[model samples]
Target: MARDRARLGGRRAAGLFAAGTAVALALATGGSLSQAGAATQSDAAAQTAVQAPKATHSQIQLLAINDFHGNLEPATGSGGKINDIPAGGAAYLATHLKELRAAAKAKGQDSVTVAAGDLIGASPLLSAAFHDEPTVEALSGMGLEAASVGNHEFDEGWHELLRMQTGGCLPDGDGQNNQNSCPDPKHPFEGAKYKYLSANVFFTNTQKTLFAPYTIKTFKDGKKVAFIGMTLENTPNIVTKSGVEGLTFKNEVATANALVPELKKKGVKSIVVLLHEGGFPADPKAYNSCPGISGPIVDINAGLDPEIDAIISGHTHQAYNCSLPDKAGKPRLVTSASSFGRLVTEVRLSIDNATGDVDRTNTLAQNQIVTQDVVQDPKTAKLIAKYKALVAPIEGKVIGHISTPSVVRTNDDSLESPLGNLIADAQLADPSVVSAGKAPVAAFMNPGGIRADLASNAGAVTFGQAFTVQPFNNFLVSMDMTGAQIKALLEQQFSGVNGPEAAKYKVLQVAGITYTWNPAAAAGSKVVAGSIKIGGQPLVDGTSYRIVTNNFLSDGGDGFPAFTTATNKVFGGLDIDAFANYLSAHDPYTPVATDRITLGS
Candidate 1:
């Protein structure tokens, strides 16, 4: 009995309570207890407090995914594959999650499905056509209980994002409207059933979070787990300024640490952080393995409170399962499932039900592939079909034709892609855009903004394909910048402001300009001196020239801070509209020559 009590850990309190009840019953039956009995009872209570169990354990499974980006249909190209097998799509993702949950159930473990974030924004044409209602419905159907709000979640502005969470039709003619609520106008759109936690984001006026900071889930035996979700503090640096105008993002570790005491006060101890920031792995090929993982998550995890048991991360779009040390030098699980529903991270946490704390020594985490081998979930398929039918008419409309299946995002050298060049030219050539922002001398496009290559398999391109290439719906912004600022912008492509990503070379595609750079030069001086020219004239450092770029870059996205310093900014028409108009105006479009950016040494 003593050995059994010792194994019960903190549960000894319950046994003490039962013993007290037995003593009361005996005294009631026999009229009164002896002095010796009272002394024995006191001793027993003392022993119970001293023998509080530290060995009892219960396991809970956290099924996590991140950066879903609303791919209703299966993703294609390299995005869809995990090694040799095709993976990802709402249907396959749902089926895999169901199977994983069932498998956990078979082992008598409690399970919950969660996501780190980027679940809705940057969606495909099918889901984006209806304001991502189908994606929200599909996630709800899959039993997704909670997720963090990603940077893209603020793409359509926080107001529309709030509408996405609250459920309602878009206000007509309010300038905030993009797509309708649902296919059947009578049905209207139902918002997410899951919770969105943002412990970091706060309203500038209210100083309070827009959503719940965290949520606690209690299992059958009173084992509780708290999930704290938030995006990276640098959300404003990546997303548009207007979208995050009235908000401020707090540091990840600071916000998480602040919440720990409050959660402890609420009697919740086991904690998992669903962070929207992630790191790039050393090996791009390892989807479920973390070999030399390094990024913002590394430092954030190192500084986190010891109470934070595990962190499910995303946003870098790389899959990695790693165990890193926390502030106390204890190993903590850090996991991210690559974007587009390609993988699911299965984190099994052993919790002490008696103490409501995680058993750090026994925690295990792994990333599982969401392969196409699984059958599609019927509910998810029907949801996708409904949205597909609604979008088919708009999606199938032929916008224009391509001559040689050109306009690719990457060139032979992989720096200045043909598609990026075409997109930059399109923005530069739009008449309506020119009228809105005045005829710009030059335009540039960020490579990250270009989502897909212009692949014309049948020499005919549709609106769907064009929309796929530039899905952000960013408007062109014409601005004035000094040639010195332009030089600084070019220099940023290689080093300094861009941080580690600079080494990967995020070359900006240009229109109406040519420049040469030395790859072997020191950081910040990689751009060759006096090599920048426009229309065969060398760029004058003191000259103020009109420059055009998408709103994302105009606001200094992707580490290009010089764009934010631009003057006389004027917003033009949407980039997709500009690209479509340019395509129609220039039919049988062949790939542009890749002589724009030159590399010396």
Candidate 2:
């Protein structure tokens, strides 16, 4: 993953992951990688690799992906499928991209591969173990020209995000961190090859943008295309607070509109926005339909200047292609490829040579699956192989087994999922949380915190699979909250107090408690009165009880502000460690519905 074997986001600067392991073979095979500093080539060099159009007015192809999440290997289970077809793998993705570009080239079309955001973070062991360098290298190899910054990009904090943008070694390199910067003394981690554009993100102290606000790509026909990329304005509410400490995210519409005049001055008429926020659509398949589509994007798109040609979006991980109206009431092209590298949105635009503007009437967009049927890109496969071999010992160790069919994230009618219950119980039973006479009787886990279903190889769960389930390295925290505060916490799950996630449910997976909620009730009064119970007893408003949950939740992540008022907070170790150790202790664990909550009509 390093141009010389870089680590993923530089989890730590310590420990050598077998020096030169990624570089020797990768360089020999001509894998895509660039040292963060001087070794990184110029933009002109990268653009020169593409075939330019010989004819005037040739259509430009925009191949885009979003929320890749560093699934370098072919994802498995439902996560790997789109419309029931197996899809997603960096190798397969590279192959499909090459084929698509080739087809475009044959038609005299110039193509550029780009992404909306979330190319990394919440990754599998293959990319994460090396600090996501593999992912940056893979995407750069596949010709990713530009991308927006997603909330996950700041998971390790803005400083680390800066490290990813520019090349550097992690401060903790070589000896300490769980993930080494892959400790390559020679080739040092190379930053991303593509430009990370953030029109909305700014450092509070400097008031300057974190990265370039926009980048222009010129074509052979003397036409220039301007790309303005940005994450959603509400990034702070979803991600851990400390990660975005000195940064401020401006409104999506305002930021893009403000740049319109600046871009027009540069004679850049064709503008495309790569946004990290998206919406849910009526069609589940989301290949071509956009029936009844609604979300923040609809309104944001409607407010965007008509000068912006198209919108490529990610996050929410839903696939859809829609032509919604822009500010001038003209239909505009907007698309999203589902997460985990499963789909690529191919947008073809007819450029007007005279005006240097996009021909809206001729705009075409489609979501192509990164199907496994195609031959995998060999270079990328070797890159995957290089990292896989390095982390084999740790990733392959069987931590436990699934006694039941599978512990899944799928929620029942009550919104309680098997895997969620398991995670909550794991947190509650964690030795650190429960040790030394700690009396935490309840533990809660946010559904968003559980990234994936617990996967097992032939029923044997490994450390790699465990990492996938809880990829975020958040710590466990036990805090004291009186029953009144706990009840207030439950009430905050609905609208009127939980901020703008009004239509969605933010239910917490629980252990050591049971409660009921009435959906038909008013927003702030949804939780049924007197239904809350802790340790099989009725709620006691005056009594204080210790509850355990991830630090994200305790810090009021996902809008549960009641946690912020909690007292006597105690920090446990990494959440992933607790999950893996729990699996070991509860080996051959059968998953059963805990039936912790009930829903009232």
Quantify all predictions' global Cα lDDT against the true fold.
0.78, 0.78
TM-score of 2: 0.87
- Per-residue lDDT, model 2, residue 410, is 87
In angstroms, the error of model 1 at 224 is 1.1
Q: How do all models score by TM-score?
A: 0.87, 0.87
Native-referenced Cα lDDT, model 2: 0.78
Q: After superposition, how far is residue 558 of candidate 1 from its true place, in Å?
A: 2.2
Residue-level lDDT of model 1, residues 141-189, one tens digit each, is 9999999999988877788788778898754432122344556776787
lDDT of 1 at 203: 94
- Give the Å shift of residue 470 in candidate 1: 0.4
